[model samples]
Target: MEGMVVSTDAYASQVGLDVLQDGGNAVDAAIATGFALAVVNPEAGNLGGGGFMIVRNDEGGVFALDHREKAPLAATRDMFLDEEGNVTEASTVGHLSAGVPGTVAGLWEAYRRFGSLTWSRLLQPAIDLAAGFEVRERQVATLVAAQNGIRQFESG
Candidate 1:
């Protein structure tokens, strides 16, 4: 079957296409694309965040995966409130705002159920890109645009 991969980032799309060319199925390609996005499009994709995926098999069976981050068990409804009981930016910025990361688990589960390519094989492209890949002009612009927002955080 002929397959095409599309993503916001060119390098990520190419990684998915490479997986398909290497005899991988759509799920494999998607997995590769997800990893590649994390490396090349960190502004939008990262292991720190969560996402959802829905797959339809050739047999017409549909599978939905929910990998959204969940609030920590100890979190309370007013966790982001300050001593004055006023709302604070605690829940909107910094490490205090982060939920448990779910991307890795979600990707792993998707691979376990639907992936045909070896896990290592699916990851190598992203790894290579991470080790060294030319940053595109568009990516530079995106980073420049995000600098102000990123700088607002203590860790930034």
Candidate 2:
């Protein structure tokens, strides 16, 4: 009679559950979960990145969504390699490495097709979390690990 939600991050999972409790459908809860992740699990939340999703409705109908990021207009397949044909470090780091994000668009599409809640309503939890969610021990640990890893890539 109720609903359930799950995710890698506890806070994000809670947000999704809250959305469901608030009358959101699976797609709406998923969008809320994603936005919550951006605040609570930035390392992988990647608001500026893209991904894929597969959904199955209660009617036995299934849908596949390709939200994979598009390469920037200027990008070329060979861009990741240098003159020596070795993979260049630059190919995978910094702005040049990024592609056009599709996550938001994909989420919106899903919500449009299957959601029972308003888009703005789904976004509110994430907004609230960003405004005041306190940093927890696990989050701190993740941040430290992320910092250490990123520092290794710094040239100076």
Candidate 3:
């Protein structure tokens, strides 16, 4: 509160600060902020990566979460390999490149421990955005340029 510069476009930083201002702990703020960012920028800030969290309590109890993601057990060494061991385009796109997700669980733990509001409260902003806004101009242009490819991908 004294002197901190929240980076622009970083919802986590702002959210953490907001939670602190409301007397909530670090975990509460991080969860709220992480959700906001993921919703606003799914193409980039995704729920795909794993993260660890460290916690400190009033009596100096320290807790840690090793929330990192590991490759699926069903995965084989040749999962992305072509017959010749080269990566196939199909392996890198569509369903293949998608990693296991942990964002939801992380957020859930944070909310459970530190959130005062309902889950509905955390999701309202995203709901409002989707139900009532225009795509950005840059996104519109990109879509227009690749309309055929995108259409085919979605339809496929």
In angstroms, give how far residue 57 of model 2 lies from its true place.
1.7
TM-score of each: 0.90, 0.88, 0.65
State the lDDT at 100 in candidate 1: 94
Pairs of colliding residues, candidate 1: none
lDDT of 3 at 89: 77
Instruction: Pick the winner on lDDT between candidates 2 and 3.
Output: 2
Q: In what order do the candidates fall by lDDT, top score first?
A: 1, 2, 3
TM-score for candidate 2, residues paired by index: 0.88
Compose the digit string of candidate 1's lDDT tens values, residues 1-156.
Answer: 588999989999999999999999999999999999999998788899888999999899999999999999999999999899998988887878999989989999999999999999999999999999999998999999988988875452
How many clashing residue pairs appear in each of the predictions shown? 0, 0, 0
Please give the lDDT score at residue 133 for candidate 1. 94
Please tell me which predicted candidate would have the highest TM-score against the true structure: 1
| Among all candidates shown, the one with the greatest lDDT | 1
Error of 2 at 58 (Å): 2.7
Better of 1 and 2 by lDDT: 1
Off by over 4 Å in 3: 1-15, 113-152
Error of 2 at 68 (Å): 1.5
